[model samples]
Target chain A: MAHLLEVKNLRTYFHTEAGLVKAVDGVSFHLDEREIIGVVGESGCGKSVSQLSMLQLIPTPPGEIVSGEVLFEEANLLDYRQNSPQLRAIRGGKIGFIFQEPMTSLNPVLTVTRQITEVLELHLKMEKHAAQSRALELLKLVGIPDAARRMNDYPHQFSGGMRQRVMIAMALSCNPKVLIADEPTTAVDVTIQAQLLEVMKEMVERFRSSLVIVTHNLGLVARYVQRIYVMYAGRVVESGTVKEIFGDRRHPYTIGLLKSVPRLDQTKSERLVPIEGLPPNQMNMPPNCAFLPRCPYRIARCEREAWPILRPAGGKHFVACHVDVDVKERARETARS
Target chain B: MQYYYWLGGICRGNLGRSLVYKEDVSALIGKRLPVTVHLGLVSLFISVSLGITAGIVSAVTRGSFLDQLITLLANVGVAIPTFWLGIMGIYFFGLKLGWLPIWGYTSPFQNFWLSTRQLVMPAVCLAVVPLAMMTRQSRSSMLEVIRQDYIRTARSKGLKERAVIMRHALKNALILIITLIGLQVASLFSGSVLVETVFNIPGVGRLLVNAVFSKDFVVVQACVLVVAALVAVVNLATDIAYGWLDPRMRQG
Candidate 1:
């Protein structure tokens, strides 16, 4: 079967007074039907930009999707002429989006029912009574207790977790085929994050919709997502199943990322490894490996050669580095010790 | 002793006798208040509606040629003095085109059509600055609101551009717009002084200006106090509106 969504060579650039900032440069990925995928990266690593580019939601003045094809349900969204009606029909109708900071994502002035029913009325063509009932059901579905009473309340009246749930309910109102959640739990506490993740898992499974979780939290992705894509300097540095990524990670940056996070399985005394140097300045990104400066395993060849491109490294795992697989594994093993 | 007597009279709603009109202060205000109120309401209504619409358009189409054009016009409109605009309006519409009555007051209750016709030029003249201010404020407010994450969520929900702007963007921008309009009430009344004088209307603005020139302290004092009260009332209304409009404010 065809993939649920396919993004190819997506390059989203921001034109500023200084120069063109390649926010999402030459990145590519695909999502399977009902599959949960996580795009993991630090802030400004183009993780959010990459997902937003799929829906063409980036603000245009300084930002533009320069080149790419975003294929949803076999339709190319990147086509210039497909802007208004076609894209609008596909956007919330087929693919829903939940942004970071639910405090700011839900309209503060609008009642929860109004916000949810707007999507139902617009896309589902539900009447007022039916829409209101459906909105109440959505609120309940996302685990908002006493959903009927809460419908009349505005966003500001809800707690942060509750607001995030409301946002999720709004996203799921039209029964979208895919839901792109951008750092959905970053604004909430860890306990709330666990609950939200569980709610998301259950809801996505029940809805039978593919979920694309965009976040910097490696631990969260490791525990939740079936497949993962590690992004760096606007490119997919590594892509693999969760097991392959966690067990046999090849890319140095991915290794650094995994090492930086504290694992419960690890001994209490293991010091968290921090990646040295900052992510490269996007405006003047070097032609060679963008992560060369911060890469612990980077060799002279890495600096001499152009940035390595992703190549399948057997069994659903892909790595974008010049180093030999055996040598990289040996280095990783030594670092682990 | 004299001040206490004067204050006691004011407290009882007796604003004292008008020196120029030689009428009861209360009666003078009662008769003149309606004209200013009439002019103020019509001009405020027009300026707010038109200015807000222009501002929304300016913000939604920001950086477009149309946005730039509206912004430029708004700036120029704000800079143009009301008295000068009023004279130019009189020359072009009243004298040259024979379109309107250049100087006079007509009550809507007396003759609705003629009152509307008489009001058109003066109201437009009075509206220019506030309209410009409203447009500028709403534009910036709308631009700020549109940048908000909720607006993106609204658009991502497949809402039409109109729905995204009206339901999401405009509603958020309204609090700022309301505050601006509230602040403008003072200027609107003071602005009418020049506007009424240029048009020779019998509003309180004209009454106040005439009273000032004639050194009628009673009339001047009454008008100033009334204008201040109007400003205070408008501010209270704006605060109430903010509470009504924003739940976050309501909670606090």
Candidate 2:
């Protein structure tokens, strides 16, 4: 099947006071129809920049998508030199975005109904009365109570969870083909996160849209996405199916991420292992693999050379590491024994 | 109930008679009120347009030469006294150049062009304070509003740069701008006294000045009351406008 979206050699840089910050350096990924792909990365790992760059959302003068080809259905979005009318038509209509902060993402002055219906009117070309009616339907779909009456209420009147649902409803208003959820659950509580995730999952299935979930929660992605892309310091170091990632992770960063989580299946006596050292600053990344400074199994070769190229390990799983595969496998075996 | 009583008295034309003019206070207000409104409205329109446009330009190109120039002009405008500015305008445009007539309000119906010509210097003088103030306030407010998350969201939604600033940022900044306008209205009335005296325009500012000099207690009280009432109405309108611009204000 043809890829729904393919971002190739994407480089996003921020021209700041210090120096040129390569936030997303030589990143590439793909999304298929009706498939949920997890982009797991710690903060400042370029996951958010990759998503923002794809949508041409980075602020110019300071930030820019210097090089990229964000191909949607084989059409190059980056080829549009400016904010052409065609690009505007594609944004809220054919491509939707759910931002991290629901409180800030929404216009505080506007009503939930007004926010939802605006896209419907602008993109769908629906009349006011028709758009309003559909807005109520959307509010109901997102599980907001008294959809008709609540339509007139402003965003401040709604709770955090409800506001997030409103944002989701607005994103889904025009029924876009792809939904880019950038840390959608990070702002909410754990219980609300679960509920919101369920709502998002159900909505994705109902709409049959491709989902690119950018998050740090490996556990949440494990349950929601079929494929996983583990990113570190602006590079996707590993890509594989959820089973390959969780069952037999290849990259040390991915393994560290998995081990850091407190799994229910693990014995209560086993303490969670945190990833050591801070994530590298984009402006001053080392010459070798970015995670080398922190990797427990780092060898002399890892320090002396640039990062290894991404190579297929087996059966669609890929890893970017110079470690001896057989030795790591034996070590895993010995540790298990 | 107090407002209603005041409203009834105002409607009954019982604002009391002026001591100096010895005319009904309401009649004096009716005669001079239109002039103040005309001056205030024109000055406000000029200031808001000039200020907001300059502000947006300054914000978009924050550290550029044009931004620095506008900042300097705004600073100069704020520091220079309105009365001093009015005297200089009269000296240069009215006296030295003799390009414009210095005083008196002409009936536009009798001679529209001449009436506007007469109004030019005084109106521009009356506008100086508001123009300077609105520019600074609007620039700061627009700067803050543009930094908001919704502005970024709007841009990410693929809205044009102009649309993002005008529709999203400008609308959010309007409540504060309108409040500035309200506060400036009271000061503008006070400044008009100096302007009218300098230009010799027979507006209420001159009338109030004359009343004060003559110790016409009734006229002084009546003029003060009328100015106070106008200020109150303008503030109330601004408060109502806040609710209109931001529905969140209505709930809170």
Candidate 3:
């Protein structure tokens, strides 16, 4: 079957005053219908950029989709202009987006009903009365309390988590096929992160839509996302099923990421191991592997050759690396010593 | 004693007679009120509509040639004095081009074409600074509002670029723009004083100026009183607008 969405060799660049910034350099991924996946990367890794570029949401002039094909259900999304009616229809009609900073994601001046009903009216051609009822239904579905009374309140009236629920309600109002949640809980309290994710995951499954959770935090998505695409320096360094990535992570950067985050399963005595060094600056990315400086297991080939493309390490597992760092085995060997 | 008497007369709706005009202060101001108000309203409408349009255009096309030209003009507009601009308008439109009259106020109801032509210089002079101010304020406010997450959310919701700007961004931008308008009304009122004299128009501002020189204290007091009252009403309207544009500001 054809992939629900496929991004192949997608390149998005920013023409900054300093120089050209390869914000999303040659990223490729696919999602199946009703499948849930995660794109993992630290800040500035272009995970969010890649997701936003699919909808052409980034500001142009400074930002541009340099070259690439974004195929949504076999249609090339990149063919349409950013302001074209077709593109506009596809944005919230077929594909919904949940951004970070839920506090600010909703318009402060607009009421909950206006924001949610607007999408329904625009996409579904629902009348004012129908849209209002549907918007109320959505708010209740997203677990917003006192739905009727709160419908007229601005974003400021709601707490952070409540606002996020409103955002989720709005995103899911049109029942989009592919829901992209970009660090959806990053700006909220840590206690509410998992709860929000649960509501989101529950809604996605209930709606029978595909999900792509883009985040810098591994722990936040580890329990929810099925497949993982590990990104670094605007490139997908590794990708695999959750089992393959956690049990048999190969890329040095991915291993570093796993160690850096504090896992709930980990013993309290174990010290968190942070990844050394930052990702290369986009303006001055090296021709060779971008992670060579940060990769603890970097080989001479990593420095000499251009970044390696994804090659199969196992079933549905791929890693772009000059060295095969079977992190699990290496840890086992180190423990024996 | 004189001040007490004048204040008491004001309470009774009696502004003492104008010594210079040899008429009742109320009658003199009453006749000229329409002219002043007519000029004020015309100049205000011009400033607000044109200013907001220019600002929105400038913001959306910040790096374009049009944006640059608007910014440049706005900068120069705010810097130019109303009296000087009025003099220049008279010299050019009145003297050189012979397109518009230099002085005097004519109601649009009298002769729309001639009244518009007459209003051109005085209104333009009065509107210049506020227009520039509105342009700058709205541009900056729009730039900030568009960068906001909600605007991006609105865009992502498949809204037409126009709807996204108009429905989402403008309401928020208007909050700040509306606040600036309150201050502008006061400045515009004060501005007409210079502009009216420069153009030799018969309005309350010119009346006040003439009263000051002629030592017609009651007319001067009445002008200040009328202007203060007008400013209060406009500010009240602005506050109501603020609540309407941003419901968050509204009291339950």
Q: Which candidate is the best by lDDT?
A: 3
**How do the residues B49-133 of candidate 1 rate in per-residue lDDT, one tens digit apiece?**
9999999999888899999999999999999999999999999999999989898988899999999999898899899999999
Candidate 2 per-residue C-alpha lDDT over A267-314 given as tens digits, one digit per residue, 9 for 90 to 100? 988899899999887887777899988888888899899988788988
Model 2: lDDT of residue A326:
43
In terms of docking quality, model 3 is: medium
How many Å off is the CA of B233 in candidate 2?
3.6
* Model 1 chain B lowest lDDT segment of ten: B243-252
TM-score of chain B of each: 0.97, 0.90, 0.95
Q: Write the per-residue lDDT of candidate 1 for residues A1-337, one digit (tens) a residue.
A: 7888999999999999999899999999999998999999999999999998888898886898889888876678888442488888877889999989999999989998999999999898999999999999989999998888879998888999999999899898889999999999999998999899888888999999999999999898677799999999999999999999988888988888988988889988779989899978899888999998887777889989999999998888998999765576686679978
Write the candidate numbers in order of decreasing lDDT. 3, 1, 2
Regions more than 4 Å wrong, model 1 = A80-83, A325-337
For candidate 3, write residues A98-187 as lDDT tens digits: 989887789989898999999999999999999999999999999999999989888989999988899898899899999999899898
TM-score of chain B of 3: 0.95
B1-252 per-residue lDDT for model 3 (tens digits): 998998899999999998888899999989888888888888899899999999999999899999999999999999998998888888888899898888887778889888888888899889999999999999999999999999999999999989999999998999989999889999988998898899888998989999999999878989899999999999999999988888778778
i-RMSD of all predictions: 1.0, 1.9, 0.9
TM-score of 2: 0.88
Ranking by DockQ: 1, 3, 2
DockQ of each: 0.83, 0.46, 0.80
Model 2, stretches more than 4 Å misplaced? A324-337, B1-34, B57-76, B91-99, B106-115, B160-163, B207-229
lDDT of 3: 0.91
Chain A TM-score, candidate 1?
0.97
